[model samples]
Target: MPDYEPIVGRYLTIEVAGEACRIHVEEAGDGIPLVCLHTAGSDARQYRHLMCDPAITDHYRVIAFDMPWHGKSNPPVGWRDREYSLTTELYKDTIMAFCRAMELRHPVIMGCSMGGRVVLHLALEQADRFRAVIALEGADRLEPYYELDWLHRPDIHGGEVCAAIVSAQVAPQSPDEYRWETLWSYMQGGPGIFKGDLYFYWYDGHFDDRSPLIDTDKCPVYLLSGEYDSSCTPERTAATASRIAGAKATVMEGIGHFPMSENPALFRTYILPVLDEIRGAG
Candidate 1:
């Protein structure tokens, strides 16, 4: 049977984006640092399987943090003032600030959804900062952009909308038991936070027609998409990867939007190969 033991770590307060936010972080093993970033309006808990896997932890110092205002992290006063927009600038600034706070060096960054898409900016601008990046359900730009006006109405429950979206994106063959766990972040998202995040996912954070901005010469890029992800199809992700000279793309069959959380045991089947290759390269 696969190891199901839980990994433990600290809920430390770190200054990110000019605010003292308490980030929930978990880790295992020691070697190269692997920083896991969560999806939009989600937290680091999605990476529990990777953090706890003895095989992965044996070589990687896996660290996952909840974004300020997303999980257990406290939202700064500025964010509470309804300044919920997540621009590319805010995203990268927080990442750098967080990295500085953690003193991580040459770490490999891996993320999904919003976490996956925003890092394209980093790979392009500050390629030398990290060894590589793995993006899941990522694309230059996610189309079929949605309008979430109903979520903001006075009487409707927004979490249900989130649940519906997650349900629709996740493959039916995915473990039925894990579906709720995958919805936890979206269900718990702050009002307008999910919608605000989509603004960046579909627009400001977009990389469409901007291939010239990328420089894979400095850092390696790997793009992974799920077979069930309708929002960011595998074809789109592969096309995006093709635009970059050295980037690699792969499709995770029988998976969906929340690849890690959809079923980590299954997700690892594909993830390990990529990590192993990265390790071999080094």
Candidate 2:
């Protein structure tokens, strides 16, 4: 069982592109800057344990935010835009905007799942702004799995599935369960948010050309996966790491798609070391 500690932090609303978003920011330690980004449908609290870990916080200023339309953040007026408000090109732009609003310097980004995709997007768009990136369970391709078609499956009863998922999300049994459920609840946003994310998940063509997004010599990158992760294979992630000039990859021993949530101790063990190495090099 993973040790759990719910984060008790203050909420700060920052203006980004004229819109105010309520973000959960915790100031921990003081050395290199570390920004933790959660998977889609989850809030910044997903990194609660990591943020509290002395191994990590003792050496970095950690900050995380709930993507718009998720957690306590307000959604954009144009929430139905083709790009997903929570995790997309537009969201990545907002990330930079948010960082600027906070006056944060170049930070090492650690993003999980959809958050990883956002980090990758930023790395491609502005490599200099980020010193390094740690991607967990994130994919470079939109349609990573061919046969499942997670986005659209007329035969699987989408509404029913989403409803059940939503209910489970809202009715968590414990703190840990609440963390997991909170994530699912975010996924069950209004039709516009959900549909918008679905569209991008299935048809986004931005990742077709990968070279431009990955830095050949500047940014240091690392990819982490769970041994049993079906969403992203170690081989695929390794190949992605191979493409980026100074990137490395690894898989957590006996875990699945959500290593941070499922096996956090192991997740921290492997990830903290890499962060230390990067900070030392810096």
Best by lDDT: 1
Worst 10 residues of 1 by lDDT: 144-153
TM-score of 2: 0.77
Candidate 1 positional error at 41, Å: 2.1
Best by TM-score: 1
lDDT of 1: 0.81
User: Mind giving the per-residue lDDT tens digits that candidate 1 earns over 1-282?
Assistant: 977465766777776656677766777768888888888767888898787787898888888887777777777766655757788887888888778878999888998998888777778877899888889888888774567676555687777777777688788878887778888667888777777777778778888667556877688888999999998898888888878888888999999998998878889999998888878778
Supply every candidate's count of residue pairs whose N, Cα or C atoms clash at under 3 angstroms: 0, 1
For each candidate, give its TM-score against the true structure.
Answer: 0.93, 0.77
lDDT by residue for model 2 (131-243), tens: 88878866676453333233235675543454344333221222465345444544454434444444444455235367345773577777787666555567657666666
CA lDDT, every model vs. true structure: 0.81, 0.63
